[model samples]
Target: MTSYPMHTVDTAPAEARTPLTVLRETFGFVPGAAAVMANSPVLLNTFFSAFGHFRGGTFTPAERQVLLLSNAVANASEWAVAFHTLEALADGVAPEVVDAVRRGARPGDPRMAALSGLTVAFIEKRGHLGEADVKAFTAAGFGEGQLFEVVAGVAISAMANYTANVAGPPLEPAVEPHAWTAGTGAGA
Candidate 1:
């Protein structure tokens, strides 16, 4: 079903994959998607490296998860939301936070609400938010740095999501069971 064969380290090309080490070091297992992206590890590592750089910044880890979920929900990617939502909950976000995000209420939690608002504006405006929107989110207390991280989150998701859609990669055996109810590719 996947455009590229779902591959393990043994199947993926050997030399191109600093991402293999990057993912293994970060998550303790090389992610299936990372292995697939290893066809051109440049593609995988470019985004992964950008994520590592953003992740090293000022926002709390919880805030990062919020931004991740906001983008996933906006893309209507249940596959994305499912994995990231579990990560959010593990980081102590309430289940209501996920539910609120799904229903488009900005999720009530402050960090996530900011993320949700930013995500909605970015998607709806196609990345052209007005000055007032920036003022409003800044009013809500997300600093300029976190705002940038949110943008980075969207960028990373955009890359992985379109790849996954066209690839139709089978959900990783681990992430499979967490699939959520909304997505562009549901049952397709």
Candidate 2:
């Protein structure tokens, strides 16, 4: 396995320190996955900016979690899944909804199911979403603009998911209860 440095604001490069601090302040701590990415200031900055954009977009907190959790699951990223699962639950997404996404199934709610399905297809298709996919997504009552919103969410989720998979960032204790493996049925 390739080892990546897990950075703290004090130890991170000048450019990375600010973002790491922002992450720590906003999230109450810097996520390990973000810290690992801090090895490259550019990568860390890009991740932070894209994540900020997604957070500032139109999706509700629950919708954002669905996309991110689905992305983590699609990438088979244990660490990202755990982080997202905790955030999703805290955001008041139903436990069943998070569970279904962890299990690679859609949420019971039709609208959520559509969002999850769109995220899966978007990831699996590698952003070459077709008209049919768009039609189905829109049929779920999301607007065409939200499709673009999904794109932004996917970008952030993909970065986090791939980073966690590649670096195996340690799960924070707060999220340990939700720690997950790719196929082990959520967490222990």
- Those runs of model 2 whose alpha carbons end farther than 4 Å from true positions after fitting are none
RMSD of each: 3.0, 1.5
Q: For residue 26, what is the lDDT in candidate 2?
A: 82
- TM-score per candidate, chains pooled: 0.85, 0.95
- Candidate 1 ranges with C-alpha deviation above 4 Å: 183-188
Q: Pairing residues by index, what is the TM-score of model 1?
A: 0.85
> By summed lDDT, which 10 consecutive residues of candidate 2 come out lowest?
179-188
Q: State the lDDT of candidate 2 residue by residue for 100-133, as single tens digits.
A: 9999988899898999999999989998988999
Q: Compare the candidates by TM-score and give the number of the best one.
A: 2
Candidate 1 local accuracy as lDDT? 0.69
Clash number by candidate, in order: 0, 0
lDDT value, residue 130 of candidate 2: 88
Model 1: which ten-residue window has the lowest total lDDT?
179-188
